[model samples]
Every structure is written in C-alpha cells, then in structure tokens.
Target: MAQRVFITAGAGGIGKVIAETYAAQGAQVYVCDQDHRALESLRDGITGSCVDVTDEAALDDWLQAGLAVLGGCDVLINNAGIAGQADPVEALDLAQWKKCLAVNLDAQMITCRAIAPVMKRQKSGAIINLSSTSGLFGAPFRAPYAAAKWAVIGFTKTIATELGPYGIRCNAICPGAVSGDRMDRVLAAEAQARGVTPQDVFEDYASGSSLRRFAEPEEIAQLCVYLSSDAAKFVSGQAIAVDGNTETYHSV
Candidate 1:
C-alpha cells in the first residue's frame, strides 16, 4: 500500500518539495497552504488545499476531509509557520507574537492532538516538524519565532515519548538559512533592521555556517521525507539540524 502523507504549508518552498518527494516515492500526498493560487500551481500529483492552520475549525475540517479521501494519514509534516515582523521584544507588537505562536506552535499541537489518535489506532506513524536553527539558539528580533520553534522541539519530544510505545515516531527538522524567496525576505528584513545591504546580510549568515552557503529548500525537504519514512523508524524525540555547522554560532 502506498504510504499516505499529509503536509501543512505545502504550497511552496520546503513544504511543497516535501510533498513532491513523498509522492515520487509512491505515497499518497496531500498538501495544504493559505495561498490558494499558489497551492493550485503545485503539480497534479499532490492533493492541495487552501488552509489557514490558525483557524482550528478549518484545519480540523480540512484534515478530516483529507483523511477521508486519503484513507488514513501515515505521516504528517507540520510545516505551517510564520516569521513575524522583526523587532525587539520591548517594541514588538503583542498581536504579532500571538500570531506567530498561533501558527508555529499552537497549530502544530492542534494537528498532533487531532491526528495522534488515528495513528495510535493504526499503531504506526511518523511526524516531522519544520523547526529552525533558531529553535536551538537565540535569534535577535525574532523572539516569537524562536520561542515557537523551541516549543515545537519540545512538543516533538513529548509526543515521541508518549507515542513511542504505540509505534508513533516524532521528530523535528531544524534547517539553517534555506535559500529561496524566504531567504531573500529574511535578508531584506535583516538589512533593514541592521542597516546593511541584503548582500551583506546573506554573506554574514553564510559565513556563520561552516558550509558557507545557504541550504536549498529541496535539501531540507529531503531530510523531512527521510524522517517520515520507515528508514527512520528508530529515530524519535530528536531535533536534527541540517545547519551546515552553524550550531557553532550562538548568535542570531
């Protein structure tokens, strides 16, 4: 039987690549994102939907509907998240923090809460969360994102511990600066905040990593796909960093 995989924030970037990777591996893949048009543009092999994970009802309904169609989810990639406005905590908007937590942390919890029972019944499953290098270290001007990602790491471990006996494995993928539009946006934001050119921001982050280059979205997606597969059946409760040695740099 083809493995049934469900992924959040799968319209583009790492999420989209993850969906494609699994689908190519003969899994039935369903992907959801808030951008309807972008979701539609994804290849036909994926089951795509426009979903705002922050809306509990909508997320639940979408998941239920997807489960019904896909027969039961064997794997879930919780990739929906937001990098809110960059600002110091003292000047940060509370709403921005709340929103960041809503999508990054709370939404993943909700999805896990809703799906764990199904996996428990099946007695086998894997959950791959999209955390960040920031989760393992402090990131200036991104307190909320960092906090929520840290929460995701903790959440993955909790689930892994609780569900380990049930054969449900949970793990997080902490990616370093992924190269793409998201990187461009982050670079632009950093440039604005630090009064440097985007090129300088990119150079600084690249230099921080031992590889001296940003990771491709496909590279991150490949790790996620592997974690969700039977190959990683023994792996659980771990936060694996695909960071190219940036862990050495504690700075944001």
Candidate 2:
C-alpha cells in the first residue's frame, strides 16, 4: 500500500526533495508551502497546497483537504522553518523571535496535535521533525532558530513517548549547513554582519563538519525516507544528525 505523507514547506529545498523522493517510492505525498510559484513548480506526482504553516487555521484547512484527498496519512514531515533574524541576543528583534518560534516550534506542535487522533486511529504512523545542528550546539546570532530547533527535539521525544503506545513513532533529523539558496542567504547575512565575504562565512561553516561540505538536499531526503519506512521500525524518540558529523557552528 502507498503511504500517505503530509509534508510542510514542500515547495523547495530539503522539503521539496523529500516529497519528491517519497512520491518516487510510491507514497502519496501532500505538500504545503507559502510560495505559490514553488508550489506550482512541484512535480505532478505530489499534491501541493498553498499555505503558511505558522497560521493554525490555514494549516488545519490544508491538512483537512490533503488528508481527505489522500484517504489517510501514515507519515508527517514537519519540514517547515526559517532562518529568522540574524543578530546578537541583545540586538534580536522581539517580533522576529516570536515569529520564528511560532513557525518553527509551535507550528510543529500544532500539526502533531491535529494529526495525532488520525494516526492513532490508523494504529501506525511516523513523524519526522526537522531540526538543525544549531539545535544540538548553540548557534551564534541565530538564537531564535536554534531555540526553536532545540525545542523540537524535546517535542519529538515527548510525542514519541506519548504516542508510542498507539504505535506512532516520532524522531528528529538535524541537518548542518544544507547546500542551496537558503545557505547562500544565511552566509550573506553572516558576512554582512561580520564585515567579511560570503565565501569566508561558508568556509567557516563547512570547516566545522568532518566532511567539510554542506549536505545535499537529497541526503536529508534519504534519511526521511528510511525513517518513514519499516526499515527503521524500531527507531523512535531519537534525534539523528544528518550533518557530516559537525563539530560546531560557531567558527568565524
């Protein structure tokens, strides 16, 4: 049977690849994104919806429609997130901080809360929450993003325990410096803040990883695929880092 998958931010980046990968594996993938263009760009195999995950009403509406079309859901990839305001703790914008938490942390919880009963009824499901290396290690100037990710780990663990009895598995994937447009933007911001070149910032980030390179989006997607499959049936309540064994994110 093809699995039903609900993925947040499936229009681009890591989320896009994960949706595509799952669809390729014969899963019924439903993706939602705020970017209409990106949503439209998604391949025909996956269902796409325009939505902002931070909004509970919008998310609920999207979920209702997608699950209706999908029949039921077997997996959820809480892949939506933002880089947030890049600034020191003292200089951080309160509004941006709140918005970051609202989208990255609170939204994931809301998503699980809405879908718990559905998965529980099914008697089997998996939840893969996207976290970050920053969650494991403190990220300088990206406290809000880090904080929200850290909370996700705790959130995933708690849900794994709560939903375990119902046969629902919950886990987190932590990626470090994923390559693409988002990383470019982050490096640009870090460069501008430190009065250095983007390349310098990139090198600093890569140096922390044992592989000394940013992970390809597909790399993260593969992990999601495995976690959602029976291949990882016993994996739950764990935070797995897809990073290249990143030692730190504080260099430079």
Candidate 3:
C-alpha cells in the first residue's frame, strides 16, 4: 500500500524534490508552503497547500486539512525553515532573530505536538527534520539560523525518545551547502556581508566539503525518502549529516 507523506515547505528546493521523489515511489504526497503561487505551480501528483508553519493555529488547521486529503500521514518532513538575519550580534535585528526561531525551531515543536496524537493513534510514523551544518557547529554571522537549527536536533532527539514506545520514529538530516537558487541567494548575501564576490563565498563554502561541491536537492531528497521507508525502520533519534564531510573541516 502507498504511504501518505506530509512535507512542510513543499513548494520547492529540497522539499519539492522530496515530495516528488516519494510520489514517484508511489506515496500520496501532500506539501505545505507559505508561497501559494509556488505551491500551485508544482507538477502533477502533489497536493499542495498554503501554510505558514510558525502560526500554531494556522499550521494546525493546515495539517488537519492535509491529513483529511491524504487519508493519514505516515511520514512528515519538517523542512520549513528560513535563513534568518545574517550580521554581527551587535547589529542583528531582534525581529529577524525571533522570526527565524519562530519558524525554524518553535514551529517544529508545535507541529510535532499537534501530530504526535495522530501518529500515536496510528501506532507508527516517521518524522524527518531538516537541520544544517550550521546547527552542528558555529557560523560566523548566522547566530539566529545556527541557534534554531541546533534546537531542532535536540527537539528531534527528545521526540524520538518520547515517541519510540508509540512506534513513531524521529530523526534529523543535516545538509551542507545545497545547490539551488536559495543557495545562490545565500552566497549573494554572504558576499554582501563580507564585501567579497559571490564566487569567493561559494569557493570558501565548497572548499571545506570533501566533494568540493554543493549537494543537489535530489541527493538530500533521496536520504529523506529512505528514512521514511521501511528500510530504515530501526533508525530513530539520529542526526544524520548529508554533507560531503564538511563538518569535519568547517566549524559551521
């Protein structure tokens, strides 16, 4: 039988790829994103909804609505996140920091709380969260992003512990420098912040990776799909790094 998969930030990037990969594998895929237009533009076979995951009530409603359409959710990819304020601590905007934490950390907790009952009732499920190398280490100018992502790892582990008896597995994926428009934007932002060329920042990021390159979204999607499948049934409370050995060399 096909599984029902619910993915946050499913409109594009790694989220979109994850949805498509699972759908191709015969799962019923439902995706949620704040960008309605982008969600609507996705190819066939995906059920997309507009959801701002940081808003607890709004996200709960959206998740419930998705469950209704999906029949039930066997897998959830907590992929919604933002590259929050990037600047020195003294100049960092509190609003941006709070907003980042709201989406990247708090929203994950709220969504898990809302879905735990359903997963427990069903007696099985898998939750895959998107973390970052920044979460595992320190980044020079990404205090907010790092802080929230670190929290996600801790959150995933805690839930895994509590949910294990219920047969609901929880794990996290730490990806490094994924290639996409979002990555381009990040490079541009870093360039602006450091007063260097975009290529310079890209080189610096790639230099630490063992592959000497950024990962494609499909690569990360493959890992997510595997974790959601029966092949990884015993995996839980693990933060798997999908980076090309970047964490070993890079502090962030």
TM-score of 2: 0.94
Local error of candidate 3 at residue 148 (angstroms): 0.4
lDDT of 2 by residue, 1-252 (tens): 999999999989889999999988888899999999998888878989889888899999998898788878899999999878778999988899999999899889888988899999998999999998878988778889889999999999999999999999999999887888978887998799999999998888888888998899999999998998889999999999978987766521
Report every candidate's CA lDDT: 0.87, 0.89, 0.88
Please give the distance, in angstroms, between residue 198's alpha carbon in candidate 3 and its true position after superposition: 3.5
Q: Name the 10 consecutive residues with the lowest summed lDDT in model 1.
A: 243-252
What stretches of model 2 exceed 4 Å from their correct place?
A: 191-197
Separately for all candidates shown, the number of backbone clashes (residues 3 or more apart, or on different chains) is: 0, 0, 0
* Residue-by-residue lDDT tens digits, candidate 1, 103-160: 9999898889888999999999999888889899888878888999999999999999
Model 3, C-alpha of 42: deviation from truth (Å): 1.6
C-alpha root-mean-square deviation, each candidate:
1.7, 1.8, 1.8
> Least accurate stretch of 10 residues (summed lDDT) in model 2?
243-252
TM-score of each: 0.94, 0.94, 0.93
